[model samples]
Target chain A: MYYIDDFLALLFGISLLIAFWKVRTPLFFIASGACLTIIYSITLFFISETKPVQDIIFYSMACLGCISGLLFIRVMLIRSISLHALKLSNTMTKNKKECSIEDQLTEQMTSEIGFRLDDLQQKGFATLTTDGSGQLTLTPKGRVIAQLVSRLYRAIER
Target chain B: MDTLFIVALTTCILLAPIAAEIVLKGRRLQSNVKRVAPLYIVIALCCITIGAYTHYPHPIVIVMYWCGYFLTWFGIRSHLESSILLKMLTTLQTSNLSRDELMSSYLQSYSTQSRIAELKNSGLLESKKGIISITPSGEKLLSIIDLLD
Candidate 1:
């Protein structure tokens, strides 16, 4: 039982360090959560005289749950920052009724959107390739992700 | 057996929102975490009370049980709040939205505007005569993000 307490404390302490490092990606959190679960489970199994499987499973499940919660919060904050960046990048003048006569969104929003596109490409979830008419199309990976999201949307009815 | 029962109950409590979503035919209640979280909390508390009366397990068991509940609460709240991005992704997946249209619509939403107002109120940015600018602290935050990237 004391070991379980120590395990929880250590899990949270490592999670805090990761948060401070600003590694706020969902993938990072998921990977860390899984990795830590396995590592701790093995450590506890070997270290305990009785090799309790139930304790190991319990700790692993708790770790995964807590890490997932932290990940969701972190990603939410990161997405908000993206919006804040777009807002902060706004450079509208007082006299101008619009940031640009042609652009509905401010220049900053466009640029941030472009950055997000580039980021998706860099992450290999997407790619930018111009067609014969200079139109862009999703890569195979992008198509797969898009299809998955669409299916999920239909399933959830959201 | 007591430990097993507590663990199973915690899992059920954690999964209640999903079950609620299914039972309600995917209709969310007011789209707020507060609306659904209390039901889970009440259920958890009832189980804990009954378990305590029956067994009076170690204090650590009680502490661990509540910690799990806290994690469940946080996870549920975060999931509900962060569904905005999922919604956006779903929209993008189903239909095309130009960058301008997307950002403009996002800004037009009352919640987004309120969030921006919050940033301004929190001193991360300031609005003067309709022009918004990031403060030094905001710059510091951006720099940290950049470093992380």
Candidate 2:
């Protein structure tokens, strides 16, 4: 019995060590909880005096172990949720303004529908400079309205 | 000798998890060692209560168990934290940023230039033109961080 216990304990210990060294976050917590629970239980065997007290103590330790494990898992879940929310916010923020401008430009150039400004230049929708830049930089009226719409979109998104 | 071996083995088992937790928690947050010590106390209390009721060994044996437990905990925790720090350094080394940009963004350190230089000298990173990259060994170290993330 002792040998089996020792062997299992050693195996558990080595696995725990490997988990630490590898630093795999998910395995790290699981391995830690397992090793701690096993070690506590085995060590208790050598220390407890009365059978009733021993049983009670072991049961409580098990409960504590379960709670600790649950807490660690809870923290992990919260961390992942917060990270996801941040990523979503960042993506929305970066694209929100640009998308609104694209929409407004599309609306103003109704004749060039389904065509990019660059494409329109290629199809002679507007003249081009020798350098191939578009002649019509959105007029101040277009620019101002586009900017306002973009601002409104951002405000609504937020 | 058998008793001592059992005691030592038990300690290792107990401490491994605590060490792992410490490392994970430490890397994610700027927590103090003192703040995390309570978890170990709770584990120790559990171990003691069970040990006392089951067979009640000598007080000295019990002390040895706790000492061993704490020592293992500290050792593993320190090792894991250093490993994580090393991984972060390796990632910075391999990133496509210029020395100044790398320092400002990923490294978030004032002395990132010197730090990158140090890593290069240590053979953890190699630089070409203005681009820096992690070496194979550095990549292996960084693999740990990648796995964690």
Candidate 3:
């Protein structure tokens, strides 16, 4: 019975990792991470007859594993080095003519800027304001996030 | 009781990376990952080996230590790997930067030619008849990454 419970815990833990790896956005990650953790913990609690300390440690390990998995996915997705390189390659496929590095570099920069602008608007961090002129302005939430990130940057450097 | 010791040890081991990040500010995020991530892996391996020999082979504790190391490393690496635009916003929190200036500065940081040369050297890219294409492995990797995005 005990071995079976351990097996179930391991199974649930692995499933949570798979879900995390499949997550592409931060919002999806948060929702799925919370749901999966709760389900895994509740299942483990009912099946395992371990001591409180053991149960806590098991739960903690599972949570940490999920977080680590999600973070690994996040880093891979956000890394622009390879993405830019791939984009350049794809661009070359469309243009049979020899392309210069500067052209690819410009395209990459434009793509990055567009991506960030889209993220800001989607997340409500920035807004488009028009009074016969289009301008990007940070929302209150955006300002707060910017400030928090700045503080975090300073702390990391320190 | 042994779990307590293992937890404490994991906490102490985790601090090593934080110290390394602070001490190695001169290194970029990519270089730091290469240097510090392996350090954590080595420490975790040492703990696992020692636990096996000490007759207190708690596999749960080993798992805990591995998770702890990963979390610590991930926290630092992800923060440092933030997009240049986000970093610009963060800097804008203190001082404003003109759009043209920001774009120029950010663009300067990227060297597409060098990056292409690197991919070619790694055999992920090849140019045939003046047309460049990704190798099979490169295509597979790009597709996987695209799915994630």
Candidate 4:
């Protein structure tokens, strides 16, 4: 019971990863994170001593756990798309060509990028234009999200 | 009052990286882990040292510290790097783009060569006599990534 909160938080994070293991989408991740957070919060209440300081600490742990889970899912999403590097490595490893890094570096990872664009379209950030031209355009929702991301990019640094 | 101080401390921890990115910009440290890890470590150490010195107050303070630490480290890394998808959408907002245009544009985040250099730096890959190959660590990393599928 000493650091039960930390243990519970770890549990919540694991539950989140399990929930996201199959779906691998933000909506699924969000739904699971929220549900797990609520369940854990309720469970914590049942077992907690309910001391003012103690309860505060316990709830804070749950909250942080939920946030960490959410952040982790986001990292996974980014890493998933960024696995173009992995794909490239796989390609090079499987290839017999003794190409220089300089030459191989210029290789086009078109399929992965195509998949990402298709994913963006599925997520409603962009859409294929209806003129049968297949031109991809951002939706209003996507514009807003893109704006927000751009702002964050400006606000922070690498 | 104690909670107030804890909240302030947590906020400071979360902001340290952004602050470092701002304050340390253009220096050699702005590169990557050299800058971010140091900030994260120093602040985490400060939190632990202070917690130990005070013999700890309420235990939830650990929650506050860890919450801030998690957000600061992973949050910043994702925000800085993972926003490639968002960056693509941002570019689209300016105008429609074919896949090639987007890939070949200023999308450094999606740039595989840079990513290779990064992984190479991280020891996931190695370059010899201008050739590139993956290390065993990189093979392990890809296998782990495969689990997500």
- Candidate 3 C-alpha lDDT tens digits along A1-158: 24644465566557656776677676777677677667766766666554466654655565766566566657656756655676567666557547654466667766776676567668886666555334456678889888877776676656
- What is the DockQ score of candidate 4, to 2 decimals? 0.38
- DockQ for every model, please: 0.18, 0.02, 0.30, 0.38
RMSD of each: 7.7, 20.2, 5.3, 5.1
Candidates' C-alpha lDDT: 0.52, 0.41, 0.61, 0.62
Error of 1 at B33 (Å): 2.8
Off by over 4 Å in 1: A1-51, A81-111, A128-130, A155-158, B1-7, B10-14, B19-31, B46-149
Number of the top DockQ candidate: 4
> Residue B147 lDDT in model 3?
70
Ranking by lDDT: 4, 3, 1, 2
Report the candidate with higher lDDT, 2 versus 4.
4
Q: Please, what is the TM-score per model?
A: 0.53, 0.28, 0.66, 0.67
Listed for every candidate in order, the interface RMSD values in angstroms are: 7.4, 21.0, 4.9, 5.0
Error of 3 at B148 (Å): 5.5
| Per-model fnat list | 0.13, 0.00, 0.21, 0.33
What is candidate 1's lDDT per residue for A83-137, written digit by digit as tens?
A: 4443344433223333322233334444555576556546664333444442234
Q: How much TM-score does chain B earn in each model?
A: 0.46, 0.41, 0.55, 0.60
lDDT of 4 by residue, A1-158 (tens): 44665566566656655776755676666676667767877766766444465555546554655456455645654554335555566677779456554444444445556667778879998887778876788889999888887776665543
